[model samples]
Target: MLTVQPLQPATFPVPGQFYMLQAGASYDPLLKRPFSYLSAENGSITFLYRIRGKGTRAIAALREKETISLIGPLGNAYPVPSGEFIAVAGGIGIASLFSLFGAATGRATLFWGGRTAGELLMTETVRGLVRTAVITTDDGSAGRKSLVTEPFREYLAVNAHLPVYVCGSTPMMKAVAALCSDAGARCFVSLEAYMACGVGACLGCVVKIRDSENHEGRFRSVCKDGPVFDASTVVWEGQ
Candidate 1:
């Protein structure tokens, strides 16, 4: 996790919007990596990333005063609905919802989960923004010993009027969407895709979205059209 004070364009970052970052000063790695803003306050922005590859390893090697290039506030942001909010996050997907938590007052509730307690990052910061927060882990190392969906289901039963917002693995988002559908609630999902251009030109990060006029549906670029979308608009793998 790194937070930096950007030299220009200090404002207008919303939740779910991402930036392409390149930590290296040389062209050795050659491509920038995309990360959603974990939090942006005053003039500084934070990014939460796991050290999973060479690009990240290169990022880890940065020293103070070293330069980093970024192309950003890219992609669409999560919609702010009128009613209460139920946020569902899996693993580092919490990055997509933290800003929303900060913007909201008493209307948001976050359900965050991970493989273990260690992966559940920024719990204290998130807890300060929402009305209620529920944490779960697969191994029962924290909060509850069940999937986030379990508590989400329970919350949905009593508060079906609220809107649900999710950012996580594909299967988890799909499951949350289905659960919302079954409960007659509105749901929004933020997708994670392998984006090359961060813009629509490359045709690299397309996802199937329903076309009301054409039952067969169509493909939309996650970077250009959205990374955040109405759950009902997404055409899941089988359907």
Candidate 2:
């Protein structure tokens, strides 16, 4: 919702792509985290992040006019949904899934989960684009006192044919994928791994690939090859 400049392709972003930010002393390196593009337009990239640890908190304090260096718009996007779609997110993962709204221009719903109402992000931003935008707060502070996957499953029960997209912490993404697999719905999941470099050469973001059928071919770099991946391609240890 905050705009710093007019939209430009170089500055705008595509879904599933990410940026490596330089957070100068206004922040501690320990507090600068990589973020994926939410929705980019008018020479601006929109981002939604929770102010959890110090890094993100520092990012929240930055002034708009201040500029930062970033390297990205990397990784392939989830297969665009054809008919209808559902997106499930936890915490600020909406920053990762919100961009898919345009690609899912088909029809859609969003199921978001948070520890409390205060942690919710992108509800209005996404609701403005999709048909159903549901927010579930764990402390009963917002929409429903439930995890995001609850509504995700309930919605899928009735809309079994819908495609699902999910993003969040590792545990949440794993759970959503498991649910989608059980219901026979195709799913896509965005990942989060520690990264120092946002490109493949560093080999810093390796993840275990989980699904046998989908991961048939090879290994992928979250920074270069991903951050976004098919649910069936991740090997989640459930940590």
Candidate 3:
């Protein structure tokens, strides 16, 4: 976890938006990595990231007051739906949900999961924010000893009127989308893609979208068109 004071507060990032953060000061790790704005307050923004690679390891080694370059609040953000809101997150994907949960306030319910209890990051803050919180760990180390989708399925089975927002692995999001489709509930998914450039110029991260008018699928940049998209609008079969 890291919090940074932006050079300017006028353009702070909103939930679901990301910034390109360079891991180190050296040119060895040339490209900047994209990280979602975890939470923002008092003119500072927080980021949640695990040390999975060189880029992340570099980010982990930083000390206080260290300067790093950033590109900024890039990509589309999640829309605030009306009525009930359900949020689902897997592993480190929880990075994008804090602000959303805060915004939704009493209207939002969060279902978060990880491989084990220890992996469920920011448990205290998450529990304190949402109206309802459901935690799951695959190894039974905390909360329920089942997939978060299990509780999610149980919830949606009864409350088919609510909308769901998810951020996680592609397969997990796809599965949730399928569940929402069967229940006729609205769903939005934030995708994680390997992006070379935070902007759209690289054309590195793309997903196939289902076009209703053409009845065909078209490719769109995840970094530009969206990291957040309506589940029904995504073409999961071919991807």
Q: Residues 1-239, candidate 2, lDDT per residue (tens digit)?
A: 32334333474566777776554465366423578777777567766655657666556667878665566666667777777788888887887777678776586788888899877865676689888888898899999888888888888888778888888878888898898888888888888888877777778788766455565445678877787787876777743
| lDDT digits (tens) for residues 106-205 of candidate 3 | 4678889888987888899888877788999999999999988999999999987888999988888988999999999999999889998978998999
Taking the tens digit of each residue's C-alpha lDDT, what string does model 1 give over 120-173? 887887787778889999999999999999999999988888888999999899
Ranking under lDDT, best-scoring first? 1, 3, 2
Backbone clashes counted, model 2: 9
For each candidate, how many residue pairs have backbone atoms clashing (under 3 Å)?
Answer: 0, 9, 0
How close to the true structure is residue 215 of candidate 1, measured as C-alpha lDDT?
60
Listed in order, each prediction's TM-score against the native is: 0.94, 0.86, 0.95
Candidate 1 at residue 154, lDDT?
Answer: 90
Model 1 regions lying over 4 Å from their true place: none
Model 2 alpha-carbon drift over 4 Å, by segment? 1-11, 25-27, 30-32, 210-218
